[model samples]
Target: MSVKNLLHSSKHSSKHSSKHSSKHSEDILVGVGLRHPHFTDILTSAKEIDFVEVHSENFFGQGGAALSVLQQVRETYPVSLHSTSMGLGSFADIPAHYLARLKRLTQTIDPFLMSEHACFTWGHLQGQLMHSGDLLPIAHTHNNLKRMCEQVDRVQTYLGRELIIENVSAYVQFDESYLSEAEFLTALCQQTGAKILLDINNIAVNSLNFEGGDIEKSVVDYINVLPIDSVAQIHLAGCSDVPHGQLVVDDHACPVSDDVWQGYRQALTRFGAVPTLVEWDSDLPAWSTLIGEAQKARDIANAVLGVNARASVMEINHE
Candidate 1:
């Protein structure tokens, strides 16, 4: 069916738009990144998975096989739309065409949740629009924070739902950054009502790369500083293991590491079973293996939060 027809049918369906729910139990909520390589596996054999997440941009096409498959997936599981291209911190305006397409996709899918990074991507160069095509870190100054708040307010108002913004790992801290990252995030939440998608792996990677003290302590400290109620979701991902003083990247390319798992537990202790995702995008694993990682997240969260015997699954894929 065409995108318009599909959306028309969905809009008048039994379930409402802008907020989709799962047929599965939410008590043990967990999900995995739904990648094309494992589409059939997810539909056929994946059980205990509360929902599935996808890069919102992937299904933005008006009418195509991808969109059709996504519509099919929507039938079985709740879909979370994770968009990397929103560039919420950019100096230039968010492109009108991009926002309109995203709006349409949200209407079609009615994702249970939607998210983007705390970084910037597109800005004006001379007179034309240019995109860096990267989730580059944003400076943590109050001036920048004001701009980000405005951009976030604009996006949320345009989409008609609250947007979840994530904290990105940075190799270098801007010298002009007078405000702390947590402070800026808190301000954004306070001003725009947008929640945070806290990635524990990013916090760990940033601490390892720049925070220069105890790794676990610094990671946990950053989490503790953020407003507990501001976190709407959590992300658990693997990072490359590096020697002391070596650079660490949020590669999301392998099994989630020990440090990240530890931070994940700490997050649950604070955030209380916030819906989490397992992100392993680069070194994609078999569907079962990826699901195993998600199960691990469920198990750890269950143990930490005193949730018992509830079936849960975690997933991998970010960006």
Candidate 2:
């Protein structure tokens, strides 16, 4: 079946199928990343947010005020756990300690969704473990593909749930790379039964950073080649031009650019309404401002998918 058909069927087939399919099939949700600045507001006020996402590493400790705040928020909203350090493409196995903590967090929060990047952060050199503390890109080769599949499989087994892998913004390319980003991710999902968190902002950033890249064509081609059913969520964020506009950085510090918004519209048209998130990490804004951004995303999705934004929210609540 086509991806669109599969998504539609999953929603109406049965309660069991609705529980198993991507959350988007039930409702098109738009949410904001829960940052520290808005903790007080989030805790005190009754905000109408569909969901909230957080960096998983922030809540790995045994006990703290941060965990306390997260627990409070979980009571009011469905939480998504996004990781920056899992490094599924790393050569070394994911650390046992990290996986154990992740498992504990999963059991505690029972998150609506879980995700990690398609990059590596740790590796062994001369029998010693080392970490880059950054999300480094991996070569798109057959060997790398196999290694990533193994790593993703390990993570799913540890968590006892399927995970979503997100595409990272890249400023450079490797000579050893043999496949496009879309092809690599598609193959990874086919091999491991994983899903995707398609980031439209990253596609725009990469297009500007590379030579002879056309943003519109690149975005279209990339989305078209992917296994449509593999996408479970969409991410919309802002980026900045760096050093005389020669490179674009995924800073996530500003509002979503027009180009990125247009790309997001294209994605929604092709894939239908998937749960979307508005990510603004740096230069934190007031809680109200962030909500406005999420509203913008919801409006775009509503326009593209031919659904009423307010009605969709009501439906989700009833579900």
Q: Write the per-residue lDDT of candidate 2 for residues 254-279, one digit (tens) a residue.
A: 99988889888777766666778999
Expressed as tens digits, the lDDT of each residue in 114-151 for candidate 1 is 89999999987798898877788989988898889888
Best by lDDT: 2
Q: All models: lDDT?
A: 0.77, 0.79
TM-score, candidate 1, is 0.86
Among all candidates shown, the one with the greatest TM-score: 2
- In candidate 2, the residue pairs with backbone N, CA or C atoms under 3 Å apart (3 or more residues apart, or in different chains) clash, namely none
